[model samples]
Target: MAGQACLFCEIVKGERSAHVVMDAPDAVAFLDARPLFKGHTLLVPRDHYETLTDLPGEFLGPFFEHAQRLAGAMESVLGAAGSFVAMNNRVSQSVPHLHVHVVPRNRKDGLRGFFWPRQKYESDEEAADYAARLSGGLT
Candidate 1:
């Protein structure tokens, strides 16, 4: 369910700001402000669904397609060996809206299972650069 108060809904409506990297008619991908890694991205549907179970069946394929695209871009644009793509239904989901996390991973990136230490962008310009590279990867 979407509400004007929902954080992701606000982002979708352009009431709030996010470092968006990819935009689609049904969903959008943006760099997480509090990233688990440099290119860590959060992809969410334009319409708000609180959890995976609430998401409509028809939206699943396209939503995940965006996730795949972002994951691929994570590796290609950021030099990650792979990506960790995941979503929380209702348990660990921070926002009320359904969103997937696509985190860039390396051989020894120090990310232990469930031990996610957050990182910050050196500067806004650097974050924008990462966004540009990711957008380039999409093309």
Candidate 2:
């Protein structure tokens, strides 16, 4: 886990701006600035933990439960068939802090197995709209 210097940590601390989706007691979900799809969202712990091994045992269930909630939101709110929920322990982890990528997906969305093609929203407003919908689903 990185310290306060981590980018996600900064966002969690409100030092950085993110199109936040939801703020749970133990985790936070937000739209990915660089999305794999229009509704791609990231779920992370409020506290910093670099990799899976670093996460406390008590944190595991709630973390995945939140991820599942976000994934369901991707379908119900965004019209996705389902979601691609994943995390990289260390090797493919872009951020030092552990996070789950709850990417909305449909069959033949060009995501072959685990090979994802990165995408972007038309604008921040568009991203915010997605955030708002997913945020609402969290309620």
Candidate 1 lDDT at 62 equals 85
Q: Candidate 1 deviates by what RMSD?
A: 1.3
Looking at model 1, residue 3 earns an lDDT score of: 25
Q: What is the lDDT of residue 118 in candidate 1?
A: 98
- lDDT at 20, model 1: 83
Q: Please, what are the lDDT tens digits per residue for candidate 2 over residues 22-123?
A: 888899888899898998898989999998899999999989999989988988988899998889998989898999999998988898866678888888
Using all chains and alpha carbons, the TM-scores for the candidates as numbered come to 0.95, 0.94
The 10-residue segment of model 2 with minimum total lDDT is: 1-10
The regions of model 2 sitting more than 4 angstroms off are 1-4
